[model samples]
Target chain A: MKYRGKVVVTLKSGVFDPQGVTIKNALHSLSFESVEEVKTGKFFEVLFDAENDAEAEKLLEAMCHQLLANPIIEDFDFSLEKVK
Target chain B: MKYRGKVVVTLKSGVFDPQGVTIKNALHSLSFESVEEVKTGKFFEVLFDAENDAEAEKLLEAMCHQLLANPIIEDFDFSLEKVK
Candidate 1:
């Protein structure tokens, strides 16, 4: 079977987000004073083949752990769906 | 009222994604050969105050247009929810 996955990787809480901070500053300068905070993360769409749902889930988890996220500072979650 | 927004920004179709290509190659090198393709994007969480739903939606749209995405090469979508 073929599957498509959507993964979101975010920095762990307590980690400083410089990019988010910069964005907030930019918004403030643009007169968006009501904006309070911003947090930024990464999104990935992966297409691949797998034998079944269980195998696909295992592979997805391994992929996220090994390459998609930094265990020390980031966390990742993903969803997978069968594709034609 | 306060709202929380989640925004996803992705490259428009036909745009070359060097990062995604790199990730796919890396996965292959790591023996995940079933991987066929990959695409990368940005995710953002924004917290802010707005008078109502309409005001929040308008602000979010402007934020995307003005800073969150590159109009020529990327497209953005978002969801907003009220928060205490």
Candidate 2:
């Protein structure tokens, strides 16, 4: 069996987001009423073939550790679905 | 006034996800049953001070176009809220 899944990886909370901050400043220029802090995260969609649900989870984890997630600062999350 | 917002950035659907594919393969190792396809998206939580909602939207658009999103291959989406 094959499974498709999504991975969400982001910098942990409390970490400063320069990209988010820049956007926040720009929001201010736009005249937004109440703006404070901005944070950003990543999203991914993957489609592939797998043997089973349990098997798929294992593969996703390895992928997260190896490439999807950065062990240093950023963390990652994902979801799986079977094509109907 | 202050506003906190979140930005979600991702590659358009159908975009090949080598990373995702690799992850799917890994998921297979994990033994996820009946797994088919995996897709990923972004989540962001932002806080900022703004004057009003309209002003905030404009700033957010600028931010999305300028830095948050890459017009070439990636697209981005965001949400805004005023802190109580």
Candidate number with greatest DockQ: 1
On residues A1-84, what C-alpha lDDT tens digit does candidate 1 reach at each position? 999999999999999999999999999999999999999999999999999999999999999999999999999989999998
Error of 1 at A29 (Å): 1.0
Which digits, one per residue and each the tens of the lDDT, describe model 1 over residues B2-36? 99999989999999999999999999998999999
lDDT for A26 in candidate 2 is 69
Residues A10-30, candidate 2: write the lDDT tens digits: 898777778867766866776
Interface RMSD of each: 0.7, 4.4
Clashing pairs in 1: none
The TM-score of the first chain in every model comes to: 0.95, 0.86
What would the TM-scores of all predictions be?
A: 0.96, 0.61
TM-score of 2: 0.61
Off by over 4 Å in 2: B1-7, B13-43, B48-84
> A2, model 2: CA deviation in Å?
2.3
